[model samples]
Each structure stands twice: as structure tokens, then as C-alpha cells.
Target chain A: MNISGKNSISGMLKTILQICFWGGIAFLILLPILLFAIGKHLNSFVYVLYPNGICFLIFVKQFIELFNLLKENNPFCNSTVKRLSIAGKAAGIISIILGAETIFNIIVIKDEITSIFILGFMCILFLGVSIALYILSELFKQAKEYKEENDLTV
Target chain B: MGIIVNLDVMLAKRKMSSQELAEKVGITPTNLSILKTNKAKAIRFSTLEKICEILECKPGDILDYIE
Candidate 1:
């Protein structure tokens, strides 16, 4: 009964993430078609969207797993650690893609210097998040070991 | 494997059921099972004291060391 509110909130978050995951998939599928409908050419700028979309989906997946762990009241288990690690890798991949995209944009579009700077900043920011998540995953792993030892102590 | 619990041997010598000992020790049957099966990571001093008191044995009687 005490955890009912927490479970409800986790359920709500899972639902939202599920919606985002599917919506992102649909958007990725429709993006090129919509661009073509507007008579716009698909360029290197458009190529970057594919990896970004995939990274967003991966993040949704990571959050869904996290919400499931919260719902089960086992947020410090091995699965949670694995999910965090996966999310960290996903963010790292996204950061790499953003770095490449920034370089491509700088060469292809000379007038978008400010936008390119913002993209480079995002790359650095995501790299930091990835490292932080990796460290947090290691901490969770130690916590899980401690919890198991405590559970068995009695 | 340095510390081994001889809980099963003690239980058998005392002619007591695991459920009975569990109830007396105020621990769940599952936890007693963990101890008996040597699946527990560590034993608490309080639990060791309770088991010793209930079984009328020293901690040494219920634990052994192996090389």
C-alpha cells in the first residue's frame, strides 16, 4: 500500500516512454517522405537525423527498463545496472555521431556557424552524461552486492 | 569457503526440524534454509547468538573452517 503511489508514477512514466518510442519510430519513417513532399533534398544534414532518432529510441528503452525496475521495487538489481550501462553506451554513441554531424555541417553549411556551435556543445554535454551514468552504474553494482549480502545475513 | 556452517549437522543431532528452529530463532523459513544450505553470504552475530542459545551449542559447534 505504501508503494502504490510510486508504482502508479512508474506506470505513468512507462506509458509515456512507450508512446515516445513508437512516435519516434513513426517520425523516423515519415521524415524522408515528408521532406520529399516539400520538395526538399535529403542531404548530409538529414543523414544525421537517423542516428539521433535511434539514440532517442535507445534512451526511451533505457527509461522503460528503469521504470519497470522501480515498479518491481528492485531498482538496485543487476538489470538496472545493465540498463544504465547500455544507456551510457548509447549516449556515447550519440555524442560521437553529433561530433561527426557538427563537422559535416561546418563543411557543408557555412552560414550556420551558431547552430554548429550548439551541436558541438551538445556533443560535449552528452559525453559528460555518458561518463556520469557509467560511474553511477558501477555504484549501483556495489549497492546491489551489499544488498544481497545484507539480505543473506539473517 | 573458509567458514562453513554446520547447521544441518547440528539440527540433525538436536533432532529438531528446520521449521521449529526457524520459529524459535525468529527468522523466516527461507532465511533458515539459506543458512542450512550454506547459501548465505554472512551470518549476523545476533542470529548466531540466537541459534547457539536455542540449540544449546557453541558457535564453533555450528561452524567449521576448511582449507
Candidate 2:
């Protein structure tokens, strides 16, 4: 199977990611309006989702851009490195926001312990993912440099 | 990067054009331009050998080291 090209794996993945991202965007836009129609208020949990969801969307958008590069058969380019770093930073921001929300839940709102534990767990998970993405971005940056050097070697 | 390719000098000495050299060496004109413009990071030994053989010159005649 081809790694990159018009009909390659990366192209399929890019299409899938585009579907999910647009679907999620639609969901993000419609959910609050639907809830408001039923006269629902902005609960703490729901409010937290807005900020974190935006960050998550940005992360997915970066991945979509990276996959676009792969589909173009130029995965080892500067844009891929930039997109990966942006995605990593988005993940890191999500971790920090979740951590702050968890703290707020414990101190101000006094949410249930199980809920707090769940939020804390998610915070740690995102932190781990953020670190891993950052490492991957660095690896890709080095790979791009090596690829440029190799391409110039004639 | 400090290693400069004086391919143009050797080509001129042989009274050959870049396009002809590119074809004779089995490489693209774009690659030849890259080498001539010093944008290439490195060159393969085989390509160097081919260039030397075609130009009938030594590698040193085409490559120079500048501080």
C-alpha cells in the first residue's frame, strides 16, 4: 500500500479526519442552541467543555493539515513540523485548562469526588498526550532536516 | 556548505552548456542548477565520478574549499 498519493492511506485518513472535524464543528455550534431552546442553563461542566472543545478542535485541525501534507506526498516538509508543534501546544493548553477546571470544581463548586477524579484523570491523560506529541514533533523536525539534506545529495 | 562546486568553471573549460552536461550525466537540469548555485547540501560519489569522467577533469578541478 502507498503511504502517500492521491488514493493512498494518508488521503483516506485525511478524508476521514475532515468528516469528523466538520461534524464536530457542526455539533459544537448546534448543541448549545439546542440546549438553550429547552431553557437550559450553562452548567459548570458544560461551560468547561466550550474552552476545552475549542482547543481539541484546533488540535484536530492541525492533524488534518498534517495529513493534507502527507496526501501531497511531502510529509517531510516544514509545514508538517509546524502543524505538529501547533497540535502539541493545543494539547498542552487543554491539559492546563482541564487542570484548572478540576481545581475550581474542588474549591468553588464542590463537585463529587468521582467527577473530580475523572476530570483529574483526563488532565493527566492530555498532559501525557501533549508531551508525546511534542516529542513526535521534534522527531519529525529532525526527519525533515535529514530529508532536505538527502534530497540535495545528488 | 563551505565546500564550493566549481562545476561551471570546468564546464566552461570543456566548452559545454549546463543543459548538455545535465543530459550526459543523467541528471535533471534543476539538480544541475542546484549544484551550480551551491544550494545542494552534498553530492554522491557516483555523480561526482560521472561528472569528472564526462568533463575529463579531476574532482579537485570542480570542487573547492573556502573558509
Candidate 3:
């Protein structure tokens, strides 16, 4: 079938939506790493520091690179993005559980707890960002469906 | 400003069910139905090439100028 002007506009819109959804997800994935790196730097002031601190930043940077490659329509990026999103979700859930544990310890243990609070807050922030990424991943999946349907008509 | 998909014609010519075509084309039957009904918004060259190859017909066999 001929792709008329209307079809072209709608196709472009779908492509734009796909980009926005994935780009938004990439930003959300970066947010937690950014927050954690900053938190780690601040922790150095209080005689408490994070172990494996830089690893989070490095992993997230790699994910961002994958996101860019996906934007370029690299075939490998399709599967890689799905895998990284699952990994990101698991990391988020772990962070959230750790945050809850820290909060519980602060309440029950009744010790000097300002540092625990900071870490707990950072974990909660990461959880929020991670949830946003999950939503964007769902959006990407939906956009893929839309593209497939559009493809059939042409 | 009008063209119509003759997907049904191609499918009938090949004696292929929409579900079977969808399986071969790697798309769902619902989408195949939409294409057959001329309700689809776009088509990709690669997908068209695959469909034409499977149906053993030219693009003209499955598409018609409507206006």
C-alpha cells in the first residue's frame, strides 16, 4: 500500500513517541546513579563511605550508552535494553529493601543515625527513579506494538 | 490520495490463512486482519518484501491504486 501523507505524519509521531519514552527511561536510570554518587561523596564528610560506590555510576553510564545506541536503531540494543531494564528493576528493588532495613534499624537500634537516614533517603530516591524507568519500559513496549500494527497496513 | 491493500487477494491466491500469514510474517493475526481490511497506517519495505516473497507475488498483486 502507498504510504500517504497522513500515514507519514502518524508514523513520525509514533517514532517520536518511541524516542521520548526510551529517552525518558534512560534519564530515570541515570537519576539513581547520580544521586548515589553524590550521596557517596557527601558520606566522605561524616567518616562513613559507600563500598562499590563507583560501580553504580559506571553501570548506569553503560546503560545510557546502550540507550543511545538503541536510539540509533542498532539491532542489538533491542534485547540489551530489555535485559538492562530488568537488571535496573532488580537493583531498584534491592535498594528499596535496603532503605527500609536502614530505616528500621535507625528506629529500633536507637544509635547515632544521621548517616543511616541519608542512605535511606537516597535509597528511596532511587526507588522512585526506578519505578519511572519501569513505566517508560512499558511505554516502549506499547510503542513497539503500534509500530508493528502500522507496518502491516503499509 | 488513495490506495488499497489487496492482502486478501494475495492470501487467497496463496491459499493461506491470516493466522498462517501472520506466523510467517512475524506479526499477529489482528494486524494481518487490519491490513486486509485496508485499515493499516503504514508498511515497511522489509516486511513488504517478506510478505511478497512468501506470497510469491509482486507488490501490485497485493495493492491497488484507488484514486
Candidate 4:
């Protein structure tokens, strides 16, 4: 089978995503310990980090699956659609959590406009990604049906 | 699924094995099995023509409409 450049790129991206996945896990586990060791306390740090870390991990997993599909040259299969849908749902949940965090920040730290803006921006970014992924998943489903029909057309 | 593929019946009537028909029709045996088992979603005109030519039969001989 002739491997396309797309597969090569996806393979590289899969490696990067795997690195990010493990790095994120390590960061999440060590952040609080590091903060305590440094004698610094930030009440919202752990709370924000945990949810965002989980969401990022889920996104990395979805991308890993997607890259594997590309490597297999079966990007339009049902599993790809499922992974995209899961990614979309995870992003949606992350957006909601970010929105809630923004509200909490606004109420608790009234003068921290920079942090609030950043949180709000991330919320919108994740929401947009969620919508795009959901649409892509639908398109993938249609493409998968077409591929199945074509495969059986012989 | 109202359209049924009767390829196996036609092959049996012509005293032909599926593997032999598949070789003559230039399709994989797995694909011929798909058509024979009525699992195929669609058939190409070229493939149908080849199958008909090899089986010495009409397209309708290998396909049937069942309501």
C-alpha cells in the first residue's frame, strides 16, 4: 500500500499528541505538589487545572484515534465519526466549565479583568471547536455511508 | 432490500462454482459471495455485464425484485 504524505503527517501528529497527553497528566499530578513546595498558594489553580487537564487529555485521545485512522487510510470509518463526536462532547463540556469558571472569577476577583477575559476567550474557542467537530462528525457519517456503498459496488 | 440478487441460483443452474464465476467475471470471490448472499448494496453495470456474459444469462436471471 502506498502511504500518502497525509499519513506521515498524521503519524507525526500522533507522536506529538501522545507526548502532550503524558505531559499533561504529569503536570496535573505535580502542579499542586510543586506549588506547596514553593510555598505558594493559589486557591483557583487546582480547581481550574483539573477540569481543563481532563478536557485536554480527552482531546488528545480523540486526536490520537483520528491520527490512527488516517494512518490506516480509513479516516471516514464509523470509529472516526465516534471519536469526533466524543471530542465534540468533551469540548462542549470544557466550554461550559470555562464559562462557569469565568463567572466565578468575575465574582471572586472583581478586578482581575485579564484572567476573566482569558477564560471567556478559551470558552468561546472551545465552543467553536465543539461545533466544528460535531459538523465534521456528521460529514464523516455521510462519507462513511458512501464509502460502504462504493466498497460493495463491485 | 426489495431487490434480491439471485446470483447463486443462476450459478447453480449453469453448473458453475462461485470461485470459477468470480475468476471469469474478474471479481474477488469475497465480492461474489457478497452478491450471492444479497449483502451488496449496489452492483456496477460493467460488473453486471461481465457476470451476465460469463454465466451466459441475462441480468434479470441473476437479479429479482421481491415485494
Q: TM-scores, in order shown?
A: 0.92, 0.88, 0.42, 0.90
TM-score of chain A of each: 0.88, 0.88, 0.50, 0.89
DockQ of each: 0.83, 0.80, 0.31, 0.80
**Could you tell me which residue pairs clash in candidate 3?**
A154-B42, A154-B43
After best superposition, candidate 4 residue B62: deviation in angstroms? 1.7
Q: Model 2 chain A: which ten-residue window has the lowest total lDDT? A: A3-12
For model 3, residues A40-76, the per-residue Cα lDDT tens digits are 5333222222222333444355454554554556524
lDDT of 4 at A81: 92
Q: Assess chain B of each prediction and give its TM-score.
A: 0.95, 0.96, 0.91, 0.94
lDDT of 3: 0.65
Candidate 2, residues A58-97, lDDT tens digits: the string is 9999988776676567888878878888998999999999
After superposing candidate 4 on the true structure, give the runs of residues whose Cα lies further than 4 Å from its correct spot. Answer: A1-12
Candidate 2 chain B least-lDDT 10 residues: B1-10
Q: Model 2: residues >4 Å from true position, as ranges?
A: A1-16
Q: What share of the true interface contacts does candidate 3 keep?
A: 0.65
Off by over 4 Å in 3: A1-65, A74-81, A107-109, B1-67
Ranking by lDDT: 2, 1, 4, 3
Model 4, CA-based lDDT = 0.87
Residue A74, candidate 3: how far off, in angstroms? 4.6
Top candidate on lDDT is 2
Estimate every model's Cα lDDT from 0 to 1: 0.88, 0.89, 0.65, 0.87
Alpha-carbon deviation at B12 in model 2, angstroms:
1.2
